[model samples]
Target: MALPQKKQQKSDATAARLSALNLPEGGAWAREARGAAKARVEAMGLPHPRDEYWKYTRPETLVAPQAPKAATFAPYESAVFGDIDRVNLVFVDGVFDPARSDDPAIGGVEIEPLAGVAAKDIHWARDLYGVLEARGQAPVERPLAALNTAYATEGVVIRVTGKAAKPVNLSYLQEALDTDVMIHNLVKVEAGADLTLLENGPAAGRLSKVLEVEVADGGAFHHVRTQGRAHERRAATHIFARLGKESTFKSFTLTVNGALTRNEAVIEFTGDDAVAHVAGACLGDGKDFHHDDTVFITHDAVNCESRQVFKKVLRNGAVGVFQGKILVTPVAQKTDGYQISQSLLLDEDSQFLAKPELEIYADDVACSHGSTSGAIDEEGLFYLRSRGVPKAEATDLMVIAFVAEALEEIEDPVIAADVLSRLEGWLHRRRNG
Candidate 1:
């Protein structure tokens, strides 16, 4: 059956807009993946505001080939998490800049460019380039991810064979206006290996990013990221992972402000006893701005555990969105999963939308999910104001307390503290205003 006349016209419009960019040309594996994704994008078309998933946030900025104007933020005197010891790889204007990055000579891990690897003999990445992405298309339509698979030309490809001495950091720098960038990364932690990844920076005026990971049996991977403070930038990013027996994967993201952003994560437990946790904390503070987090977790093995926790602070008509789901297959017995998404609306014009779901087929599984949106606690506000804390100070304090619950998911005390300071800075500025 063909799509309705209106829908077919919409798809043709989006595909025509995207045809201006150059697609990937590589080895058999990569070429095949790109071709498949291109076909999918044409069939599905770029997401439109009328689309169910994009009803709240318009997709005009994302699907259009022309980059929207975005003001570049002044470089911070001290970068976030600068004190953390790690090997850094830098990308500028969507291209690798070796001059501004640390040499990729970390011990116990092999770091190579994805483009380079795709041109060489068969390797582990051959099986993963877009494998997880293709799998993620089900249960949801992600046209942006498919666009990434077809056009993203470069990024770090890391393979950890043993415990890494330090984390691997990806530092992205914005250099020009309308600089469109697409980055796709692949990470593989071998059996029993441990790896930590840290990424930060405003990638480009228009950015599309994808991170793919495979955690082998008993391996562990930890990820912490801070989205760049380019307040005017727009981005769409996706993360896809598959876990083996007893493997562990945890990720946390801190987003301050942006004109537009949409982040999606998809994970599947392919082996028994695997564990996965995904969390995010975002602050949307101005008008005509939007932020979204969409997550899907699947449990195919028995005795696995998974968690999704998210919190957002929206004010001044800023809009925030969260959609998360956990699925347990019939054979995935003894599964333990939990999900929560909440928000604090600072004013009458702010909005927070959430959809949390659970699909369990296993009789022995334990699953729960909840979502809530509300204003500052009147009681708590009075308690502090009564003690001479002043209304502005008191309100800022409450905002801190509200967002703290989700920050606990970071696990790294140092990173968490940095995130808190940034959150406080935002609140402090608002209070003083």
Candidate 2:
């Protein structure tokens, strides 16, 4: 076995750069939890532009402490799950608002605000806070998440003992301008339990958030999130999950518009016969919009199944990036993994960059990944135009069709329809603008 190496010397320059952000401390947090997370961030300095992981997207804007000036735009009417029935919890500018949110207890699920039990000696979240974030550090570094752990203002912790009667919704209202928000959330689904999480709206003008989840044996966790319509907002978010025997975890995200947004997900399958899937659909239009998705999934047990599907629509000088990977450990025999990332560019100026990787140590594992980028299908566009459809309308329909393939991965019919409506609104605005 390889012995762990000693910590290296920290550069003064790197230390100075990190210090500028005025990272948060563990004032009300558990002492041990706070110390360990702070230590991790101290050891893993911020990623520099020259770093391989940050070469595609610049990190300076994300690491900075100040919320850079951003223009706020009107939100779409009753966006994301407007027609679905669910219990809602609202967070405005990263602070939980009870008056605007729903009750904590719903059916068999119990929800608690992290701020309420933050410094308490006894709490269910003591073991989960920063636990998954630390575990996900291997093979790749997540400095931003570490920073979030070291200093985050607020978030919610949810525990599901039995099947939830209704989906729990997180409605983020970004009403304040130039707001810098950081949050960490924890979720646990006990054995034989089931829960669904719905998230929507722009969290803030500048937001850094993390969610840690544990799905016990036979537990199921489903999540669907649609980022807000604020074209000038900036966000960096992470979702970490661990699955036990026979458990299932599925998450899908639809990103309509943002000035600069980067979302990262890290998932680990620890028990045999577990299943996991993560998918995203992002549409970026106009010069200032940029969207990036970075995902990593690890199979550490036998008979585990995992999948990744991502699609991006870019036009009018918009930029998109997708970095995804799947890894199977030596003992993870008979693992099944699939990954695909595709992009559609409407014009010559739009751009999409992708890096898809699969690393398998087990010989019996089945894994495949592919990436493709191209303009709209000319044949389909011609056929639509031949039907007396306007050229612009025909192009928009083809673009929508391209993204529909990825949207179909969403299982919930109502949530899928909500996403479709948002997509239609975005396409309409893009055409008019």
Candidate 3:
């Protein structure tokens, strides 16, 4: 379905405003890419809250008329990765910064800023640049995706060669700036390749909007994402992955800070033996405000497996939301899919919502989903308190246990320890209060 004529006019206005801005210096190809993107945005109108898929998210608030233009490159402090060894590509204000980045020369991995690649090397981007926008017809229309296409100043592109055994880690840091920033990152993992990607959002700022990702056949991608945006910042990320024959994709997101944050992951299995596992945890207190997690899995091929699990803890007036759906097509015979979402509300004022759905077309396939929301087990709390434990400490112990299920999926012990340590600190503060 196409957008209405009125919405089309609004998109045209957006394009006109975008065209008036001065873009960074680049070759004819970059100019052409930008032009094409602008035209695409013009053709696809803004997505509204009325759209079924976006009913929960209002785009108007994010796409205000006076929204800042695509920000220019600016000097900013770099994120400290400490001793963790990984290929780091930094982008400040949505523009790649090589000076602030550290490129670890790992064998079998090619890491470079997308803008640095030759026109010929970016054939993949040309082919798949707008693939997500085209495939996004479900509830129909994503204004944020359209905005990314229109204003994406720079991006990071990583290509892992076929059958490359080593994993490539990517850290996306958005620095705090006076202006809001939008990033549209396109990642491609080739067939028979394996990659471990770590995507970290801006430490603090009003960095807002969407991010899209794609994975190919025989490709394996593991992602660790952490969001620690400023209290005034509101951010939303949209991750899309396509798995080929015998491919595997795993992802985990940790939301530690943000006034309002929503992270969505969409995965499609197009070939047999494809597998996907997604897990996430949200930690929030009084001022944290809102956190939403959405995961959708589609099995289009036979003999594919998919699993999704999400856990959240909310205290004070903080709110948590989880929505997971699994779809198995008729051709997806012998499909195995499972999903579960559980949340613990620490106070009467706190709120949690869990929604799980299953759509199966094949009778032979096995698909199931479950969701639950409740306060911490009072019986368990009583047992611990009766054993001479402080009530606050006892509550913290239960919350830790609830989140441990998702945290255990982190394979790297050092990374796991870091996450655990952060959790401990958050708990300590809550107990003291």
Question: Is candidate 1 or 2 superior in lDDT?
Answer: 1
Residue pairs in candidate 1 whose N, alpha carbon or C atoms collide under 3 angstroms: none
- Name the TM-score of candidate 2: 0.93
- Sort all candidates by TM-score, best to worst: 1, 2, 3
Query: Residue by residue across 300-321, what tens digits does model 2's lDDT show?
Result: 9999999899999998998999
Please report the candidate that would top lDDT against the real structure. 1
lDDT rank order: 1, 2, 3
Give one digit per residue, the lDDT tens place, for model 1 in 172-210: 888787678899999999999999999888889888999
The CA root-mean-square deviation of candidate 2, after full C-alpha superposition on the true structure, stands at 3.7
**lDDT agreement with native, every candidate:** 0.87, 0.84, 0.67
TM-score: which is higher, 1 or 3?
A: 1
Query: Candidate 1 regions off by >4 Å?
Result: 1-3, 75-78, 386-388
Where does the lowest 10-residue lDDT sum fall in candidate 2? 1-10
Give lDDT tens digits, candidate 3, residues 1-433: 4557646656665665556555444445555655665566566555455555555544453555454333222343233234456667666555667787775456656665556642343355655554664465354344456556555556666677754444444455554454566666666777777777776655324454444556667777777766653444566667777788898888887776566677777788888998888888888887456887877788999999998888888888888878788988889999999887888887788887767778888989888777888888899899999999998899988888888878876666776676676677668866767
Task: List the pairs of residues colliding in candidate 2.
Answer: none
Q: Clashes in each model (backbone N, CA, C under 3 Å)?
A: 0, 0, 0
What TM-scores do the predictions have? 0.95, 0.93, 0.84
Residue 228 in candidate 2 has what lDDT?
Answer: 89
